[model samples]
Target chain A: MSVQERKQRERAERERLIVATARELAEQQGWDAVTTRRLAERIEYSQPVLYSHFRGKREIIGAVALQGATELAGALRAATVTADGPRARVAALARAYLDFAARNPAVYDAIFQLDGGLAYAQEDTPEPLKGAFAALQESLGEVAGNGVHAGLFTETFWAALHGLATLTRARRLPPEYIEQRVELLVDRLALV
Target chain B: MSVQERKQRERAERERLIVATARELAEQQGWDAVTTRRLAERIEYSQPVLYSHFRGKREIIGAVALQGATELAGALRAATVTADGPRARVAALARAYLDFAARNPAVYDAIFQLDGGLAYAQEDTPEPLKGAFAALQESLGEVAGNGVHAGLFTETFWAALHGLATLTRARRLPPEYIEQRVELLVDRLALV
Candidate 1:
């Protein structure tokens, strides 16, 4: 490999390291504790090096959110692939989405709650975000009834799943009723 | 009026004033700007007086959340009451819910996002919260279909509405599609 190519690869590797370290810190200690200075210390890099890759904590959070979106997209796609029918796939998708949020609370917050310096629902939205929506759309669109737009249906269904995930995490909903709620959502909403 | 009775009445009024001031301050400047010092100063009460009404910020937030719940219940009830049928009532309820969240962003945050020292979906849950669900169930129960628990169905529907509200607020979903999303949620989820 040429020297220039190697330098570019090293830069990409450092950026990945910074994002991974930030996500770890956020998951362990909450976002409030994930300051740039502390991230620098934990990553064993100078603050300047961290700043070189990310403008600040917000950009780092955006990176984590993007990585999280990519993961969520992959998980949703994998869960739906093995399901037998539209109804089963939708149910599996719901479970996978909720599980992702429950398992990765910090990353979920970065994508949904915190200011991650990411452009969402805009013309220039990032690829990973679009990918996450596409993941949901792939299954949900199949179940969206005639005369309904798939993208709109996906957004609505996605929002509902988001609500279930967040409210359950906040302890606003009974944990024991989670499966019942999911079943009800699928039975009631899925056209299949 | 008797002296003791008068004092009790006066104290209750003072508590209301404190809660209202804190809520207003929160709405205007945000929850971060809602320090006890600012609340006390705005209400023209000493810090001890503020403490007397509530222990600290968390309790103040709890008060706001309870108040917000009561208001939400009222809003939902008022909106659904005059609607022609189950479907129209559900649609009205959706509109009222999203409208409330948008109009009262800080209070909505208190009820959902922030830790407000409130019990939820439990035996010890607050009255206004119960009232809020009762309002939703009043309409949703009618359309819950056979053999399904209205409360569980209501919870699922509520989560969907919540997801729309929060995601829309966070800009995760396009604003222009808000009405379509609401319509889709009602059409898909509401049995009516």
Candidate 2:
């Protein structure tokens, strides 16, 4: 490889290492404990070296949120693709969304709660954020009635799923009834 | 009043002053700025005196969450009572919820996101927490189909609303479509 190409590859690798380390630290001790100093120590790098890759903790969170949005989109696509019917697809999507939140609480918080400095709902919003919403709309559009505004319906459905994930994580909803609740949401939203 | 009664009343008044100061600071600059030391200074009380009322920052957050929950329940109840039908009631409830979250971002964060040591979904869950859920469920029950489980439906509906609120606050959803989204949610959950 040329010198410039080799250096570019090395830079990308270092960025990956930093994000992986931040994710591990956040998962291990929660987001509050994942300070820039702690992250540098964990990765055995100087704080300045870490700063070269990320502007600050918020930027690191933004990186993580982007990674999470990609994963969420993939999961939603998988759930929707494998289902047999529109209602089943919606139900699977809800379950996948909730399951992702349950498994990655810190990442979920980064994407949904923390001040990640990522632009949202604006023309300048990052591609990953738009991609995630598109994934949901693709699945939901199949169920929304013809002549009905699918985008609006998707927004409401997405809102409901987000609520369930947050409420469940907050322990506001009983754990054992999660499936039934998802079913209810799908059934209600599916019927024309 | 006797001397003991006067002293007790004075202490209660001081506690109220402290909480009010904290709430104002939070509203002005967000929750991150509402530190215990800042609150103490704002209330013109020593750190120890503030601690006498609240164990620490987390306890103060819990107090704020409780207060927010009470207000949330009142809003939900008012919305439900004023609506002419089940779908209208649910729409009203959703709008009220979004309005509350938008107006009291700090208090909403305290109840939903911050670690306040408040028990939830457990046998020992606090009354305010249960009261908030009860308020939502009471309205949801009016629209939920016969044979649909009340708790499960309420949870699903709540999840959707919560998702919308958090996403809107995070700027993940467009603000202009909030009313339309609520209408879609009500329609999806009610007769369509």
Candidate 3:
């Protein structure tokens, strides 16, 4: 590779390493524990080096959220594609969405809960965030019912799933009935 | 009144003052701005006095959450009571719940978002929290459809509202369509 191209490749690799390390630290502890100093120490880089890539912790969170959004979109698409029909696809999507939230809570929080400094549902919204929403729309649009807006229906259904995921994680809702709750939500909300 | 009775009454009044001041500070600035020192200064009390009323910030949050729960339950009850039918009552309940969340974002965070050191959905759950759920149940139970456990149905419906409230507050969803979102949620999820 040319010298300038090699430098750009190295820069890209370092950025990925930084995001991965931050996400790992957040998952291990909590978001509060993912500090720049600790992240620098963990990545064996100087504070200045970390600062070069991210302005501060907020930008790091934004990076993590974007990465998370892409992964979430993929997970939902994968889950739905294997299902048999519209109802099945919707159910799979709900389960996949909830499972993603449950399994990678810190990443989920970065995308939805934390101040990741990401714009959403706007003209300037980032592609990964929009992709995640579109992933939901893909399955949900078919079930929006006549005379109802598909985007609005998806938003409502997604909100219900968000509620279940966060409440269950926070222990505000009983964990034992999550399966039944998922079934109830799908059966009632999805037109298919 | 006896001297001892007067002392007890004064203590109770002081406790109320502390909770009120903390809540006011949180509402005006956000939870992070609510420090014990700031709270003591706001309440015209020493740090020791504030600490005596609340073990720390967490206890203060718990107090705020309990208070919010009681107020929310009242708001839901009042909104649903005036509605003409089951469908109307459910719609009223949804609107009231979202309105309460929007108007009292800080207090809502205390009850749902922050770590208030509170137990939920348990035998030992506080009465105000239980009362809030009961308020939702009063209108929702009737429209839960056949065979579904009323409590589970209520939980599912409440999660949807919680999702909408948190997402709208976080600016993750379009604000203009909140009315239609509520109507869609009610029409789809509520059997009545």
Model 2 per-residue lDDT tens digits across residues A36-105:
8888888888889988987888999999999999898998898889888777787788788889989999
- Please tell me which model should have the higher DockQ, number 2 or number 3: 3
Task: Give the per-residue lDDT of model 3 (tens digit) for B59-86.
Answer: 9999999999999999999999999999
lDDT of 2 by residue, B1-192 (tens): 599999999999999888778778988998889978888888887789988898888888888888889999998898889888777888888889889999998888888877788998778989998899899988888777888877777878777878888888788788887887887788878652
Which candidate, 1 or 2, has the higher lDDT? 1
What range of 10 consecutive residues in model 1 chain B has the weakest lDDT sum? B183-192
Instruction: Give the residue spans of candidate 1 off by over 4 A.
Output: A1-14, A45-52, B1-14, B44-49
Q: TM-score per candidate, in order? A: 0.91, 0.94, 0.96
Q: Report DockQ per prediction, comma-separated.
A: 0.81, 0.81, 0.88
Judged by DockQ cut-offs, the docking class of candidate 2 is high
Query: Candidate 1 on A1-192: residue-level lDDT in tens?
Result: 699999999899888888998899989988998988898888788889987887888899998999999999999999999999999999999999999999999999998888989999887999999999999999999989888888888898999999999999899888888889999888877898
Clashing pairs in 3: none
Q: Number of the top candidate by DockQ? A: 3
Model 2: CA > 4 A from native: A1-5
Model 1: docking quality category: high
Please give the lDDT score at residue A69 for candidate 2.
91
* Chain A TM-score, each candidate: 0.94, 0.93, 0.97
**Where does candidate 3 stray beyond 4 Å?**
A1-5, B1-5
Instruction: Assess the local accuracy of residue A48 in candidate 2 as a C-alpha lDDT between 0 and 100.
Output: 96
Query: Which number leads on TM-score?
Result: 3
Please give, for residues A41-117, the per-residue lDDT of candidate 3 as tens digits. 99998888988998888999999999999999999999999999899999999999999999999999999999989
> Number of the top candidate by lDDT?
3
